[model samples]
Target: MKKIILSLLVLVLAASCQEQQKIAFVDNGQVIEDYQMKIDMEAKFKKQDEAYKRKTDSIGQAYQLDAQQTQLKLSSLSQKKQQEGSQQFSQKWQLIQQQLQYEQQQMEQAFSKEMDSVIKSVNKFVEGYGEKNGYTFILGKNAAGSVMFGKEEKDISEAVTKAINDDYNGKDSKEDATETTEKEEDK
Candidate 1:
């Protein structure tokens, strides 16, 4: 009917005239870089890497000592026996080298896996933050240019970074909200 069509048009117009969505953006790189968890993880991995280096160095020293003794024994060996001893020593060295390479790769893989977890946590936190704060849309601006341009005022990257760090430090979001409200009231 004409009346039904008119009513639908009126409703649509009213909805369209309502306030726009609450949208904002964050710098993806900055948020991840400034996150305390990532920093802590990096430090942890660095310490582990240094310890690994020390351990490998010790293993090499021990191997060199043993190799020297083997060399001395080989020197007193018959020519044919010396050649066999050298071949066996060479094969052992190759095995050691392979083991070291494999261990190094494993450590690298572990590091990568941990970093991936950190990144996922950050993204999940950001999603929860946007939902809890009544955001209609929250864009992430990364190097790939997902967001071409955004107003500086709408860039909530710093607040988000601080919030995430506070969360990492075991500080609640409610406390942060209360503090922000109090600051605004004082102002």
Candidate 2:
């Protein structure tokens, strides 16, 4: 009975050691920002942003010119007519400003929504990669503030960036293999 109990204790101790996990840390922010796909997205956004700004500026300049013309015409009117024209001009100006503000807000919201979708897709790819590679825990840079201590080897930033870019580029492992097999079969 003592021998049997000793054997069971040894087995439990061995199992406990075997269950120890390997952990890796990554700077997820750096990975995302430095990713090739993310850079392209940023460039696209900047291009669209410049175009939007140009359009907004043109509208603003036209509005200002129209308002100036209305003001110029105000001096030629009777007092009662002048008051009514001034009030109408105020209302129109307010409405135009409000509309511009709302349009800018809508553009920002739309950009945010699209960025959220892209980030979610990147996260899903990371999760799938971790699972396939048997990683017990893949910690983000913010996980424990351990990534900012200047340990270059501990940083998996490049790997995460490459993985994300590769995923975004649709270089799927199985798809590539299947395509190769099909080509060979065709030949």
Candidate 3:
């Protein structure tokens, strides 16, 4: 009876000592905002947006100049010529407006798609991170509150962000090295 009770106690203790499933939560917004890749991508997009704006402004200014010139000459022309010129100007202006609208829409769609891809990439990285780290579950807490109340100790946003940035920096360094090697070879 003593031996059986001792053995049972040991078994219970061993079972109690078994590792529990690890769980963590990441603040998705915090992680993405601190991510270096996202910052760089946003800067690139901003530059592109500025360039597009400049191009559109140039086109708009040229159209405006042409329209103003047409308006100035309208009063001096015969009524028929004035009517024809006005009609031509209106058609050209409409065409330019439509083109600008289409270009703006395309630019917006492209930016939206790129942003979506970046977000997806971030989410994928987090998923892989959880898998590699042996986390049984990694919940995301965003504005929508997928994770309502995770303990502060279990929030891995900073660690995950650092890991992601380090990974990004490593890839950038590798790319830079490759580019340098190619240039040296060309020389």
lDDT tens digits, residue span 2-79, model 1: 999999999999999998787888899999999999999999989989998998899899889989998999999899
Residue 141, candidate 2: alpha-carbon lDDT: 79
Number of backbone collisions per candidate, in order? 0, 0, 0
**Which candidate do you rate higher for lDDT, 1 or 2?**
1
* Candidate whose lDDT is highest: 1
In model 1, pairs of residues that clash are: none
For model 3, residues 1-187, the per-residue Cα lDDT tens digits are 9999999999999999999777888899998889887898889878988998898889889988988888899989999999999999999789978987897888788878877877898899878777766678889999997999987778878777777787787753334434433442343
Residue 110's C-alpha lDDT in candidate 3? Answer: 82
Tell me each candidate's TM-score: 0.80, 0.76, 0.76
Looking at model 2, which ten-residue stretch has the lowest summed lDDT? 177-186
lDDT tens digits by residue: candidate 2, 65-113: 9888998999899999999999998898789788878978887887788
**Which whole-number lDDT from 0 to 100 does residue 12 have in model 1?**
100
Model 2 residue 18 distance off true place after TM-score fit, in angstroms: 0.5
Model 3 RMSD vs true structure = 9.9
Worst 10 residues of 1 by lDDT: 178-187
Number of residue pairs clashing in candidate 3, backbone atoms closer than 3 angstroms, sequence gap of 3 or more or interchain: 0
